[model samples]
Target: MKGYFQKKKMIEEIDKRIIRELQGDIPLEKSPFAVIAGRIGISEEELLKRAKSYLDKGYMRKFGAILLHREAGFKANGMGVWDVPAGDVQRVGEIMASFSEVSHCYERPSFADWPYNLFTMIHSESEDGCHEIAERISRATGIKRYKLLFSTKEFKKTSMEYF
Candidate 1:
């Protein structure tokens, strides 16, 4: 908290302007940052530089979409953990990514007791749909050792507000 506050304090007036402008949707035109820069009376290069600086200083985690799964009819969300062998981890991960239901997949470190290493997030309209996708991934990867963890409650999701 102290570090974040200190960093927040370091932001200059121009950085605040950039942050405020970026809080809304960037333009969809060819040069979106250029348009933003023009609106803020700064060059495109400076806008890009300041944006990169903001990210490096941990002010922004990422610039990406925040999917509303519930609103999109994907009410069920499950994180499927697979205990894949070290040599087969990448291959299994690729196979898991082929499924549209698998929104996000990655290889994570495993603990001594918890050997699950490959984690894949499955989102669907129903729990059964998620389970079906997990089963399909397991069968396709030939790795039967896996578990699907379903969410018991839903929480609202939102992006950061740095105005």
Candidate 2:
């Protein structure tokens, strides 16, 4: 099967190198991109320009930071899944995504055994906090048929390396 990137515009060698550098751990410095550009033998301005170009051309969907929630006192991680009606999925998903506690929210295909169509990744300081956030989301959306699956252990959490 063809991957998503296989259908997108082909990138140059420099772009591949830039993506490789970007996929790795960015330096904890004042000018991280500058450091990356320096290593890649490109000016910081050019790096930013190309990155913005990628966004504009839909080569990249978004550029965002990966938060280390565990070290940041987010001890509880919950996956809140909702059985939303097909007609109301969009509206309810928007409401669920509005919650500050919710980090990620998206619609997924529902199965016969598992009827949840909406899923939200919630982070909190405690398990009770997660429950409270879920309850708030439920009240806001008025969708009571939901489940909060807490994470007991995280085996892996990493961004995809395109290059």
TM-score of each: 0.65, 0.84
lDDT of 2: 0.89
Over the stretch 1-163, how does candidate 2's per-residue lDDT look in tens digits?
A: 6644566656678999998887788898999999999999999999999989888977777777767888889999999999999999989988888888898999999999999999999989999999999999999999999999998887988788886
Report RMSD (Å) for each prediction in the order shown: 5.9, 2.6
Model 2 misplacement above 4 A? 1-10, 29-31, 55-65
**Over 4 Å off, model 1:** 1-20, 26-39, 43-65, 160-163
Each model's C-alpha lDDT? 0.88, 0.89
Model 1 per-residue lDDT tens digits across residues 1-163: 4767456587578888999898779888999999999999999999999899878877777877766778889899999999999999889889999898887899999999999999999988999999898888888999998999998975855666775
Worst 10 residues of 1 by lDDT: 1-10
